[model samples]
Target: MNLEELLKSIIHQENELYNLYKLGETFATYELPSMVEHFKWLAGEELRHKRTIESFLEEDTLKGTAVIDYLDSLSLEPYFKDERAEPADLEDLILEALIREKHSYELYDRLSQILSGSLSDIFKMMRQEELKHAYRLKILYEMIGE
Candidate 1:
């Protein structure tokens, strides 16, 4: 995909993640207090990431950088997964969130491998954030299991 397309896709995926976090937050309300807090934190982080990516896109566009549609092929599998667990299954909710974070990390990591310079740096940063999310979610998941 072209640079602009890729960026748009990334932003969309990030927003989808934020929405998923919101869904998790709603479910958390009836579960553990800690779960509610964690979901909110994750949702906020996702929203922040989405805004960051959008800012980067705007900057790059204004700079007349490589945000064109020149990719030989443009195909990105959807990254957002539905949270299928019921409200009572708080652990399942956490597991689903963890899975989303891991998927996002992998997606950004893959993009970074194909890109260079600023794009690469942005993807790497996003990948790192996803990793952080996954780590926190993993810890929360473990605590809930305990």
Candidate 2:
């Protein structure tokens, strides 16, 4: 895959993550105050990721080389495992987010090894951020006793 294709894939994944975070935020709002705040923070992080990917594309640094269809076929199921399972409470939501973040981190970390230049750095940074988010969610889950 070329740089442009890789960047586009990254952007697409970021958008997906943003949507999930929004859903999580909605779920969190109906729960305890602490959870509401935690989900909101996660949503903000997703937005930041979206902006970063957009900025990278806008710089014209990524060259489109690979076919879009082929890249799109890459399955993201592992990152979105709970898309079908409805969360029962704030703790459930936190656990779901933690799982998603961990999957994202693994995916991006693997992708980073194959990519080079700015795209590699971007993926590495995203993976790191996801790890942090996972850690935060884990802590929240423990605090909520679930």
Best candidate according to lDDT:
1
The count of residue-pair clashes in candidate 1 stands at 0
User: Candidate 1 — what's its lDDT?
Assistant: 0.71
CA-RMSD of model 1: 3.6
Would you estimate the TM-scores of all the predictions?
Answer: 0.73, 0.69
Per-residue lDDT for 31 in model 2?
Answer: 56
Residues 1-146 of candidate 2 have per-residue lDDT tens digits of 55565566666666666666667667666655557667677888888987887886788644452223344554545653435445666666666667767877977786566567767887899889999998887787777764
Model 1, TM vs. native: 0.73
Task: Please give, for residues 1-146, the per-residue lDDT of candidate 1 as tens digits.
Answer: 55666667778777877877787777667666667788888899999988887987888742344333323432345453333434346676667667777778877787677667877788799899899999988887777656
Over 4 Å off in model 2, which ranges?
1-13, 56-60, 64-77, 80-85
Off-target runs (Cα >4 Å) in candidate 1 are 61-75, 78-89
Span of ten consecutive residues with least summed lDDT in model 1: 66-75
